[model samples]
Target: MPRTGEGTTVRITIGRLAEITGVPASAIRFWERHGLLPVPERRSGQRRYPPEAADRITVLRTCQQAGLTLNEIRELQEERPRRAAMIRAKIAEIEERRTALTRAQELMAHALKCSEPDIVNCPKFREEMTGWRPASD
Candidate 1:
C-alpha cells in the first residue's frame, strides 16, 4: 500500500487503491465498468486513481450495504434532475423492507417459544400471524 501524502497529488494503481480502501481489484474494475467509479488516469499499462477514489469507494460500499442495487447506485450517480424523487422512493422501499423484516423476526422469535411441535398447527401462532395461510392447509 502506498503511503498517503500530505496534500500532495499522489495517484496510485488499482491494486494499491484496493489495498488502501479494503476493496478488491475486481470490484473496483466492476464498479468502473458500471460507471460507479470514474475512469482514472492510466499510466503505461496500469490504471492509477487519485486519492479521492477511496472516498468514492467508501460511498459505494455504504450504499451497497444499505441495500441499494448496482442500478440504483448508478441511477444515483447519474443525476437527471429527478434524483430527489427517486431517492425518496428508494427510502420508502427500504423502510418497507425493514418493516417486513422486523415482523418476520418477531414471528420467528415467537415461534421458538411456541408449545406446539408443528408451529403451523398452533392456533396461537395462527392467531398471531393472521392473513397468512400455509399452502397445504
Candidate 2:
C-alpha cells in the first residue's frame, strides 16, 4: 500500500505517475522542466506527486495529439488572458489544413476515375485545376 502524504491523500513516485499516465519518466521530466507540470514534493530526495498529476499529463497528451506544439501547449496552458486568441489561431490553422487535405482528396479521386493516359495532359484534369495555385502562390 502506498503511503499517504498531507492528510489521507496518497503521494505517488515519478515512476508510478508515469505508469499511471502511460508517459515515460523522461517525458514527465521534460514536461516538468518545460513548466507544463508543477514541481513535485520531494520526499528524501525522491519526487512525489499528487494523483492529479496523472490527469494533468492526460490533458497534455491530448493537446499534443491535437497537433499543438509543446511551446504552444505551454502558452495555451499558462496564458489565460490570451487563451481565447490562441485557441482561435489554432482553430484557423486546423481549418486551413483541412481545406488543403480536402483539395488533395478531390484531385486524387478525379485521377482514380479518369481514363487519361497522362493526367497532366488530360483536358478534364487541366480544367479541374482551373483556380488551383501552387503552394508557393
Candidate 3:
C-alpha cells in the first residue's frame, strides 16, 4: 500500500485493493477485462492501482447490487454528471426494497406467532395480504 499525502498519489497493489475493497482478485481482473475498470499499471510484472481506484471498485460493487449491468455502469462512469443521478436513483430503489423486506419480515414474524398450524389459514396473515388479489381469481 502506498500512502498518499496532500500532494502525493498512492499506488496500491492488487492484493491490497482486494483486501481493502473486499473484492476478489479474480473478479477485479474480470472487471478490468470487461471494461468496467481501467487496467492497472504493472510494475515488475505486478499489477498496481491508484488509491482512488479502490473506491471506484467499491462503487462498482454498489452499482452491481443496484441492478446496473457492467456495461451500463461503465457508461454511467463515463458520464460524470449522470453518475450521481444514477446512484441516487439506485439508492431510492434500494430503500424501497428495504422497506418492503421489513414489512415482509414483520408479516412472517406475525405468521410464526399465530396459533394456527397452517399459516395460510391465519387471520393475521390474511389481513396482511388483503390488497393482493390472486390473478387467477
Candidate 4:
C-alpha cells in the first residue's frame, strides 16, 4: 500500500490527479497559481490534494467539455446551485446537438445508398428538404 499522509489525508498525488482528471499537471499547477484550485497541502515538498479536490477537478473538466469558458466556469463554481443548473443545461444542449447530428448522418447515408440517378431529385430527399424555407423573407 502506498503511504498516505498523516494528519492531512492525501487522497491523490499531483501526477495521479492529472492522470485521472485528464488534465496536465502543468495545467493543474496553473490553476492552482490562478486560485482556481485551493492550495493543496504539501508533504515532503510535493503537493497533495484531498479527495474533495478530485471532485472539484471533475467538475472543472465537465465545464470545459460543455464549452463553458474558463472564466464562466470559475464564476459558476463560485455559486453551487448555479453551477449545477449550468451543467444540466449544457448536458441538454449536448444531447440535442448529438440527436441532430445523428439524424443528419442517417439522411446522408440514405442519400449515398439511394438508387436514384440524381439524389437531388429523389422523392425522399425532396420530402426532407421541402420544409426548409428562406427565413430572411
lDDT tens string, model 3, 4-56?
67665577899999999999999999999999888888989999899888889
Location of the lowest summed lDDT over 10 successive residues in candidate 2:
1-10
**Model 4 spans with C-alpha error above 4 angstroms:** 1-7, 80-96, 116-121, 131-137
Tell me the whole-model lDDT of each prediction, alpha carbons only: 0.86, 0.87, 0.83, 0.78
How would you encode candidate 2's per-residue C-alpha lDDT over 24-120 as one tens digit per residue?
9999999999999999989999999988889899999998987899888988888488888888998999888887888799888988998998888
Against the true structure, what is every candidate's RMSD? Answer: 4.8, 4.1, 4.2, 4.1
Better of 1 and 2 by TM-score: 1
Q: What lDDT is reached at residue 31 by model 2?
A: 95
Can you tell me which runs of candidate 2 are displaced by over 4 Å? 1-6, 105-137
Greater-lDDT candidate between 1 and 2: 2
Q: What C-alpha lDDT, on a 0 to 100 scale, does residue 75 get in candidate 3?
A: 71
Worst 10 residues of 1 by lDDT: 1-10
TM-score of each: 0.77, 0.71, 0.74, 0.65
Question: Higher lDDT: candidate 3 or 4?
Answer: 3
